[model samples]
Target: MRKQQRIKKNEDFQQVFKHGTSFANRQFVVYIYPKKNQTELRLGLSVSKKLGNAVKRNEIKRYVRQAIFELQSELKANVDYVIIARAGATDLNFHETKKSLQHILRIAKCLPKVRNEVK
Candidate 1:
């Protein structure tokens, strides 16, 4: 994602957390907010050190990115997606984590019903 399009500003995160619509499931919390451009969807991943060491944190971030990539088509355009990983994420296996991600995405109504499971 381009830097300009990405939600890199701290204020943006705060706005999303404070006023934007949110949804949470087992794996991750999805925060969706409309943005200046509706032509693209940008993603943000938040994984804390409390979950584990740097390696584990990076692993979870990677999984989050992969899951989002797999569901790119299902994501609504012109929105910003902030995915916050909870402590439970570090312990879940890959497949289970994917399910958790899909759950939140569906809850956020970001996933298209026509699309099947993302492998």
Candidate 2:
């Protein structure tokens, strides 16, 4: 993800946590707030020390970043989203992480709606 597309400031994260709506799955908790008139999505990731030591936390963050980057085109634009990793997340491999992230995004309604192709 680009630096401009990341939510880096502490205040921005706090605002999302404070005012945004959230949804969760086994691996992730997602918070989202709409950004009116914007044309892109901004992402934030939080993997706490309590989830693991440095290596594990960093690994989780990397997995999440990769998943989001891959799915960026399918995500809804003009929104800020924060994804928080949970303890069970460490056991997941890349595919599992991607699946879990997709599940969470689906539950949060952050993904663009899918349409069935006509036969």
Candidate 3:
């Protein structure tokens, strides 16, 4: 993801945590905050030191970033999202991580609605 689309500041993360609504599954916790004037979405990730060593933490972050990248089109714009990986997340591979993230996003209502058509 681009730097512009990431939430890097401590204040930004705090704002989201304070004002956003959170949703969680076994693997991930997602906090969603709406930004009315913004045209693009931003993402923040939090992987605790308790989760693993540096290499393992970095790997988990990579999985999350890649999953978010792939789900970009499906995500709602003008919002900020913070994802916190739980202990369960470390065991997941890339595909599993993506699936877990998708599930949490759905619960958080971060994904836009799809129109189903009858053939």
RMSD of each: 3.4, 2.2, 2.2
| Top lDDT model | 3
Residues forming the 10-long window of minimal summed lDDT in candidate 3: 106-115
List lDDT for all candidates, in order.
0.79, 0.91, 0.92
Backbone clash pairs for candidate 2 read none
What are the per-residue Cα lDDT tens digits for candidate 1 across 1-119? 44554677888788888877989876678899887756888777788878889999999987877777777777787888888888779888677787888877777778855457688
lDDT by residue (1-119, candidate 2, tens digit) is 88899999999999999999999987899999998987999999999889989999999989999999999998988999999999899999999999999888887777755679999
Q: Cα deviation in Å at residue 95, candidate 3? A: 0.2
Q: Candidate 1 vs candidate 2: which has greater TM-score?
A: 2
How well does model 1 score by local distance difference test? 0.79
Worst 10 contiguous positions by lDDT, candidate 2: 106-115
Evaluated at residue 34, the lDDT of candidate 3 is 96
Clashes (N, CA, C under 3 Å) per candidate: 1, 0, 0
Query: In terms of lDDT, which candidate is stronger, 2 or 3?
Result: 3
Candidate 2 global lDDT:
0.91
Give me candidate 3's TM-score against the actual structure.
0.92
